[model samples]
Target: MGDRWHIEVDRSICIGSGMCVGHAPDGFDLDSARQSHARATTADANEKLLAAAENCPVEAITLRLADSGETVFPPED
Candidate 1:
């Protein structure tokens, strides 16, 4: 981890929900496969990004902290 929050989408779990796209268009997009993917590894961790994570109905979006490599969103089980 590089001291940046990296957002990850579990595409297998993704239900092709475009909520992530609407929340963080700059960061996420649905591929031809209809799965959410980050344009780049979660660079900014801004409000939109956080909201995107929160918006996922399936909770597929995961934000991993850089320093501790801890998963932030979805509340780590």
Candidate 2:
């Protein structure tokens, strides 16, 4: 979980939940509409950030390897 990752939030499905913000404030932000957005498009891996993605009620958050584009969170089946 130390590799760089690219983060994305699916606003279409985002229910404006702040769980991501609560789980990883530095990794996520809520817009005026309350939809979550990544604080940065790319960042170093961190447990909190992974937790934010994992805890998202609608699975809106996604993380991928910055270099390989491999899925990191909501892992591939």
Candidate 3:
């Protein structure tokens, strides 16, 4: 298993907050639906990527360990 990660956004919970975009412009964007969407599936999950998820006002962003399908942010409660 590698350290790659997959990013996802729950549109049902998103509030159009631009923190994710501001923190990681290349990682996420507002689609026509006005919801956050991943620019790429297997992203680098760099500091900005994590920050984008971390700064999401609605906590709608989620990061998963691609190789293991483990949730890394907002944690798995």
Candidate 4:
């Protein structure tokens, strides 16, 4: 689908493993403090983002398609 996708990370569940940032630096970034919380900066669906979500040990990252109801684990990749 061509629709934009959004990603959300639960800070409470995050462990600051940096897997999200490591896998998809363009989609996610850690604060200057490099804490457990990470921010989603991109809204495009891509394999990199999916890898990031999958690499998270805590499974705190979530990827969703904004224009469609479709959702996937590791973001369809």
- Per lDDT, the best of the predicted structures is 2
1-77: candidate 4 lDDT, tens digit per residue: 56566677888777788988888877777776655443543476778878888889988887777676477654466
- Residues 24-69 of candidate 2: C-alpha lDDT, one tens digit per residue: 9999899999989998999999899999999999999999999999
Model 2, CA-based lDDT: 0.94
Worst lDDT run of 10 residues, candidate 1, spans: 1-10
Off by over 4 Å in 4: 36-42, 74-77
True-structure Cα RMSD, model 3: 1.7
State the displacement of the C-alpha of residue 40, model 3, in Å, after optimal TM-score superposition.
1.0
Off by over 4 Å in 2: none
Q: What tens-digit string does per-residue lDDT give for candidate 3 at 42-72?
A: 7865889899988898899889988888998
Instruction: Please give the CA lDDT of all the candidate structures.
Output: 0.85, 0.94, 0.85, 0.72
Candidate 4, lDDT over the whole model: 0.72
Of candidates 3 and 1, the better by TM-score? 3
Query: What's every prediction's RMSD, in angstroms?
Result: 2.5, 1.4, 1.7, 3.4
Ranking by lDDT: 2, 3, 1, 4
**Lowest lDDT 10-mer window, candidate 3?**
1-10
How high is each candidate's TM-score?
A: 0.87, 0.95, 0.89, 0.76
Clashing pairs in 3: none
Model 3 spans > 4 angstroms off? none
